[model samples]
Target: MLLLGMAWTLPNTLLGLLLGVAGLARGARTRWQPGELALVFHRYPWGPGGAMTLGNVILNTGASLEVPCRTYACRAGLGTEPPVLLADHEYAHVLQYLVLGPLFLPLYLLCGGIGVRNRFERAADRYAATGRGWWPWPAPRLP
Candidate 1:
């Protein structure tokens, strides 16, 4: 029984680690320079129940702007916030690259990851303008 459990658990653990590393690598490949912007990480313990109960905030800041946002998943706990191994800016840009299109590439390359993140941050604002919240987790506080 122990051997069987280990066999199953080992592979899963390795796979998760690999995915985490891949995510980080993608972030590093698109990091921004200092003074250009900032990335903030926030961990929320009071998340929903089930597969996505944790939350994280990504903040980007430059000379005249600041963007703050959150993303969450339940099953992963607080650790799911951009994976601690990855820089918040890098992680945010990776997400932008994934969600946005190649239009973000020039920003990512020229202004660095911070620019890509800013574009996505603006996108999120536009999304919010539709009056629909994009967060997937349950409401943090119930009425």
Candidate 2:
């Protein structure tokens, strides 16, 4: 039974490693310029008297602008910085979308086994709605 369990876990471990490598490579190729508004990483659950926090920001100079974000709870007692982890997690989704292009949405739904395509979006909305500085910033108004 132990051997069988190990065999089952091996494939997943290898796949995760491959995905990590791919994400790192993709991140290396992408660059952000100054003065471009982008979403940064924010950690902190929607709880009473929580403060808003952000880790990083995404930016672009040209017309093409995309930011993808997601939220997930970290294991208790880990004591790691939440913003960093959230930034990595959200950026991974954005990277996947960029690398995979249109196919990303479909592939994500298929592989994630989620019933809806907006599952991630919904989660992001809920996180943002908590008012911990998750509010969407409208386009900058011009005078």
Candidate 3:
């Protein structure tokens, strides 16, 4: 089971790390919460709040972008915090990353064409809407 988990998540782990580095270089900030995953908040000041980094993970720029990552998620909004629904939606993507691993990207791309409700998205949407969804996220991602 541990091996399966790793196999399913390794790609996102590596890719997410790289993007995280890029985001940090781009002036993004990371917040780590105990008993929960950390999130990278972008601060560049562009977009409506959502962007995909490295075509793998979700990045929150400024508005209300809700996308998923591996362990963490970056959401968009304004003020001091992003909306719970947005954060939940992105966090659900994290769960999908854990389950799908490298396959996650291909599946998301192959089916997620223009947000037409592909299988990958449907599963993620379901997870994010669950009672256990929505981990605390940050202000935003890179500009």
Q: Which 10-residue window in model 1 sums to the lowest lDDT?
A: 49-58
lDDT of 2 by residue, 25-87 (tens): 333123342222213212212223111111123222222333332333222233332332233
* Decreasing lDDT order of the candidates: 3, 2, 1
Candidate 3: regions farther than 4 A off: 1-7, 33-39, 44-48, 51-58, 63-84, 132-143
Residue-wise C-alpha lDDT for candidate 1, range 23-140, written one tens digit per residue: 4433312223333222222221222311110011122222212333333221224323331212332333333433333434455345333222343433333333342332222348
**TM-score for predicted model 1 compared with the true structure:** 0.21
Q: For each candidate, what TM-score against the reference? A: 0.21, 0.26, 0.57
Highest-TM-score candidate: 3
lDDT of 3 by residue, 79-108 (tens): 232223545555566665655667767766
lDDT of 2 at 70: 30
Model 3 residue 48 CA deviation (Å) reads 5.5
Q: Report lDDT (CA) for all predictions.
A: 0.30, 0.33, 0.49
Task: Assess candidate 1 and give its lDDT.
Answer: 0.30
Q: What's the lDDT for residue 5 in model 1?
A: 33
Quality of model 3 by C-alpha lDDT: 0.49
